[model samples]
Target: MNNFRFLVDPVFSKRFGIAPFIGPKRFRPPALNINDLPDDLDTILISHNHMDHLDYPSVKQLNKRYGERLTWFCGRGTRQWFLDNHVKNVIELDWWEEYHFSKKEVNIAFCPAQHWSRRTAFDTNKSLWGGFAVWDTTHKFYFAGDTGYTHNISIFRQIGKKYGPFNLSAIPIGVYEPRYMMETQHVSPDEAVQIHIDVQSKKSIGIHWGTWALANEYFMEPPEKLSQAVKNNQLHPSSFIVVKHGEIVDLP
Candidate 1:
């Protein structure tokens, strides 16, 4: 937003994991390559340490090309991993922590999410996982990193009350199926709509689906359900939506 560019949970590999070819293969190739990104792109926001969300190869490549010119923001305990990879311009934010890029232009805040992290078998939750609330001169945005609808219901309200009525938000709407097992870790389409409401978002773009075959749900099912949920909730169709890969959303 404004003149700054930031990428969140960027996973551009053919597959989702520490190595591109190891995990769930993607149904579609990444929309663009690292080199295709705008020259002004100077920031990255990593919500957590899951291999899928924090692809090692992509991060390494980005840092190699931009070096210190790019600043990285991620949850606590992840800064060391970036430093170990030779990326020094990295900052770790705790829940509700805000980083002032420029008081007048940009401010990035890390907020809690109902999610867990496990890159390796041994380090489950050793690092933090959450979402981000970003504000530019004229717009506010939220990126709801891999999370489920929490039982408390008050979580989203708190987020909204604190830094919400987001001009735009990115909320996950897939990889949920066999509700018995996924409900605790991922939100169903209806739940996602509830989140949009609770967070007081003006508009939300669906994400975390339509790419890799990570769960058993039919890949196209998310948007279908999202549409129904929007109607059930009496929301404008465009209030929360999905964009095809490579499509751009022009916001006022």
Candidate 2:
């Protein structure tokens, strides 16, 4: 992302949902809390309006710390939520739309993802949901916030053709079990590996796992399955890796 700093889908709360403790419980704590994040972050990217990814407590803390100086980029129909919460620096984008920073050196594009959005009983699909394709003059990156592996397969190939060969990328690789119910919304580790190739990511990391006990899979199952998928595909293990929670990884 060039020299720009960004945070995506930040959640510091231990419980997620409409109420304090009425939702899924976080099994592991974040590597760094809102107070411990790097001081230089000027942007936040939210893929959708899911309570887990768009934690209210974290948003308030971020807005208070950065105010209008920090910009919030989210999917369509999501800006109103931030505005209602007094966050005035928020911007929303539709799928395939690109937003350029004031510097004109950085670009953020919202890409279509096979996922649904809902924060309440009546708001299902009211807001847009998707992944991000971001880049600067020197680096290209993709963040697959949360998506399932579509049988069509070409959707991801389309992403690679449009904006890919990413220097580094982050793709979801967990919360996928009991394929009967989860297959359409979350990708298994094996499918995640295919997405790595379909998106042409040079180096990718597994995310959205080992944090909350939202799915039926074991906490340690994701990385283990992902490792096997990498080998099954004959790709280098480092090409797609799962790091310890709170681990700092360097990107080329």
Clash list (residue pairs), candidate 2: none
**Considering summed lDDT, which 10 consecutive residues are worst modelled in model 2?**
149-158
Candidates in order have lDDT scores of 0.89, 0.89
Residues 7-85 of candidate 2 have per-residue lDDT tens digits of 9899988898777878888887777887786777878999999898999988988988888988899999999999999
CA lDDT for candidate 2: 0.89
Lowest lDDT block of 10, candidate 1: 14-23
Error of 1 at 82 (Å): 0.9
TM of each candidate vs. truth: 0.97, 0.96
State how far residue 97 of model 2 sits from its true place (Å). 0.5
Tens-place lDDT per residue, model 1, 48-155, is 998779988888899878988889999998898889888899999999999999623799999999889888888899888999999976789999998888876657
- The RMSD (Cα, Å) of candidate 1 is 1.3
Report how far residue 40 has shifted in candidate 2, in Å. 2.4
Which residue runs of candidate 1 sit more than 4 Å off their true CA positions?
A: none
TM-score of 1: 0.97
Cα-based lDDT at residue 87, candidate 2: 98
